[model samples]
Target: MSLLFVSASRTCRSSFSRQHILLSTSRFQSTQINPEIHQTQNQQTKADYPSSSSSNSSRRYRFYFLSIAAGALIGGAYTFRQSRKYEGLMPEYITNSEQLQRKAMEARPMPPPVTKHITFDEGPRVNFPFKLTLYQYVTCPFCCKVRAYLNYNRIPYDIVEVNSVMRSETKWSIYKKVPILVIENEEIQLNDSSMIISAIESYLRMPTKRFENISKLYQSVVEKDEKGKLSFNYPNKYFLVEPLTNERVDPTKQVQTEKTKDDARDNDATTTTKNVNNQSSPWFFTKFFSKSKSEHKEGLVNIGSGTVTDNETKSITSYNKSSEQYKLERKWREWVDTKFVHTLSPNIYCTLNQSLNTFRWFSQAGDWEQIFPWYQRWIIVYVGAVVMRGVAGRLRKKYNLNDNVRISLYECANEWVKAVGNKNFLGGSQPNLADLNVYGILTAIQGCEAFQDLMSNTKIQPWFERMKHSVEPHFADNRLRATT
Candidate 1:
């Protein structure tokens, strides 16, 4: 049993040793030559040596790819988990390095928005018809839309900031999306932002006891597809609901003549459109057709469709509703929802740094710091930015937007500017639904790089400032009271 082979002189480990070098000439075997190939031809069934070799090689390569992919995922997951230990604190290197000071500053999330309760006695400067409770993520554009409309119109409303991570505030609702405004009086829920505005505006105009009558117009049954996923449909959202009141019945008493109507339409659809291409569907939502439904991921709704009380009010005059000016407003509102909305993701989250900055604004504006633990905030900010960047790329391609992105953004701003023309807003003297829509969407990305660029490079800044001055402190106006 004590047998030993002869080593190369003294040591086999030496490179110059006989054992270290191959004693015989070596050659690689080719699959093209098989010992059995010569024995068998078309006369007999033969194994495909080359084919088998190629398949084996392909399988090995596939294994390598899977291994690398799996390793990367595992490594990323491990890193994320390990990062939880330092949730509130940055690593020493990041804190110490001056190069990463900005990033280090961004690591800390802003505190949640202030929570205030507004009761019925606390009426706004203007008479608001109802007590509304709006459930939203403060940074959501759709939520911002509702806010802008409410503020500009001098309506009183309550704010409930839903947690994007836990979403505990809105868990009671089936239709999960932001900008869910609850009409506290009739126990009714408004889902889409446009639909909410239309319903509320109609109520403000007519003061109907049966609010369900108007809200029901937007009611489309939620359909479950084969995948067991729910899809919400809102057809009448963009249409301005004509209030059924005797107030607008007589077209004969109208102030504008036919020539004035034609002039007004022409003015609303100003020639600024000639300078820009406004046809691209630039909305960032994946389901561009259902942009309202695929809006922000977390929010609230509790639909209580009560019976509509008998209101014998007559329909408005055909003159106002069927007017070209009305048509123009409706068209631009549709444009904002389908086209301008999509441009947001591409611009706001264009780069990782921009995305990070946006999410930081989100964390602060939505008040995520108080809602979730430090780790959740970290995941929401960093991981959410990464995911959103990928989404921005996809949205850019889906909408056929320009690679520069700013071009599409500028075109949209220009189109709106053109529509507004020589007036303060699209509604001539005041902001229309379209003006409010565009302004509100832009407001959500205010602190981001994209917004600064928009302000510096576009002509929309003046209009935006006016809109801001009008809509600022919307949630905390005279309408809101400190409920003890």
Candidate 2:
């Protein structure tokens, strides 16, 4: 199990146990002789026997040397072929200990805060009053959404680009996903794109309160699977619960709670009563919640959808028929999440040409230049391209896409454009959550071949351009940042 090799300029030193060493007076061994050949020579004995013996021995030695040489050549060829096959298929990072230590030594301290704010079309001037750090992968769509949301809201923050392979930047967090958020004082860590956005929005709404405590609003539900692995799940991950107050709860919640208790008590006797009600009329029971004694509420306190109404039963019945604008926004947002987002990676990595084009774009547009040294940049470009090419193929199959993935991408673009239908955005005059979500996902692959092709072949260009112009004013000024 243990091996040590030592080599000098022209010779190798090898040691074997004394039992393994073979000392012989003659070059021939009984095991090495061919029985048939030996018998044939024995039959022709006693005519210059010593000279014949020497000639046979020389031929045997030559064949033994030739066999060894052939094996060496075969093994060398095999190793070279395998090595070339995997030449540039995985990313290579800077592993030099000296370089890492040097960078650490060269790092500077954080500068003092500024009172400047970013101006955007959404509302009044938005300000950054807390320390915020975002850990993300530059090319990821989910990360792109968080970035776009922060930019549009004009909340300034620092971006920490995570190494996709090592992820050394996020080592301190228990949850290993990006874009992770480390908020004020570095004690609060927020995970999941949806949860991060909700938490940030809540924090912005109430700037004076401690955002670090917002984690308690969304309860962490951990479940174990058959394999005995623990999984963390957050219910209503997108919902924000404000601090408890009486006015925040719906009045109808009290009656619903009492009715629910009575129903449970009468369950054994009421089986036929429910059947009688069903027999009397065609109806369905709808789930609606009322104001509760608990301090926390499910969603934004001011939002109508999250609150309990006066006529809770009727309200539940008419929920689907309520607001047309709300329905449309929800539909499109769902489409963006389910349909439009899936088209991106498949189209970008559709072919070998597109794959290289994407990785090359990433090399320029991403944080590679700032994070990686010169030589490592080349490794990312070449290796990332090969890796992405294989990923694109697998994604295509996973999404059950067409052979020409570009067609699916184009169709989705056209669907979105048609839905906009002469309006500036899906929300009519102003862009809504759905518009931002779609635009953010697309902006991630902005300059890549797939985006260019989609713009040219579909009607999404005008809307995309509008989105870019709309968010143009909100970009924060560039500044040096410290990594955590």
Candidate 3:
């Protein structure tokens, strides 16, 4: 099935130039956060993927304990979350038919993103500022998180599907993870789904700053395990890089900003100019980033003067353009990585038949079938199904998930819904990073029995539908690939 799609997609493929790559409503090639987050062969990027485990039990327990604490804080925070009651914004290009088609998608969500042979002459919805390439597995939740962020923002990008079995497509790097985004011009390689989203998001918020400089702020802490294997911990994975006003804005670009201001009036349209919002309030940015988990307290903004304010007071009153919202967004984004994402795999692959069906679905969606030899495809489908079934079993025990699995999934959705409260999204009004993280993670399992159950059983359906309309509008094919 994948072979047929890939073969047909080739006829519609457009080639690219060497200097840059583009992507984003959108990220894939997805999940990495803590080096330990890779415990599940179902490694989730806030969104997660299937995994085969060699990780120690202690680490898993520790991670979940932290996750629980974070989840609790989020549940309480939303009760008084002073956010807006957004009716929700529509993507610039959505059609009435696409909105209606989403109803059917609740029954059967879109398959993992892959380009099918569809005719088109026009380019992608947006042209990204930097040239980027995402090397990914179509089924990975981590990649989906990145894609969710990018595509919703309408950031256009080129993607290369990595065979989960061989991963020859990612041979150029030392890090062999799915969702490795390479910023071609700077030669910066971004690994870990949370880091990728935060980096890109930070860049988007402060476009004038050199990205290489921005990336340096998100340094990783590598530690050798008992057996000498390296585990990476990006303590700031969930935090956005604050757009500090230390750097001066380039004044010369006002002409360009003005020239394109009218063009960028559409809320979600791809913009050629620097984001105008970033320009308006650089000094007011409160550098509230966490350097280590120990010091990773949220709620207070200590900026240039290093003065702290009561988080409760700050939440109620405005401090320049900064809001307690960023912290709130980060907390839930972290939850998706630690607590929420782990629930997906057990639910999706609870039974042998479900596992087989999932692998079959994956085989049909991405270019994996076309990319792999026939024997390889057969092994991936049959062998992968058996392996994931085992992985799911172990994860259930490791995560202490509910026996029914669907209950666990529902609880996870409810947890997020509770955080969102009456707001349109966790970020409110517009979908925030947390909102994108959850949506991207779930998008991976769409069209499956688990997804159908998630929609039917949970209140998440309305928010999910709203997110779907926002991300998969009619102007862009949400099949999620730029012509290579």
Please list all clashing residue pairs in model 2, or write none if there are none. 250-291, 253-290
Give the alpha carbon lDDT tens digit for every residue of 355-430 in model 2.
7888778866664776666666777677777888899889889988888998999989899999999999876656
- Give the TM-score (vs. native) of candidate 3: 0.60
Ranking the candidates on lDDT from highest down gives 3, 1, 2
lDDT values for all models: 0.59, 0.56, 0.60
Best-to-worst TM-score order: 3, 1, 2
lDDT of 3 by residue, 208-291 (tens): 446666676666664433333334566777665543445423422211111111111211112111122223333222233211
Query: Could you tell me how far off, in angstroms, the CA of residue 153 lies in candidate 2 after the best superposition?
Result: 1.1
lDDT of 1 by residue, 1-484 (tens): 0011122222443445433332220111122335444234212212411246778999999999999999999988876665553343334422332222224234422221325454333344434566777888787888888888887776766787766766766665546788777766666677889888876664443334466656655554444443334455676676534323333322111211111222322321221212221221221211121100111112211011111111311233323433556667778888988998888889999899988889999887666666567887898898889999999999999999999998899888888888787788776656777788888889888878888888888888888888787666444433322211
Q: In model 1, which regions exceed 4 Å deviation?
A: 1-114, 118-126, 242-322, 473-484
* Predicted structure 1: lDDT: 0.59
RMSD in Å for all candidates = 17.3, 15.5, 29.9
RMSD (CA, Å), candidate 2 to true, equals 15.5
The number of residue pairs in model 3 that clash at the backbone is 35
Worst 10 residues of 3 by lDDT: 255-264
| TM-score for each candidate, following the candidate numbering | 0.60, 0.58, 0.60
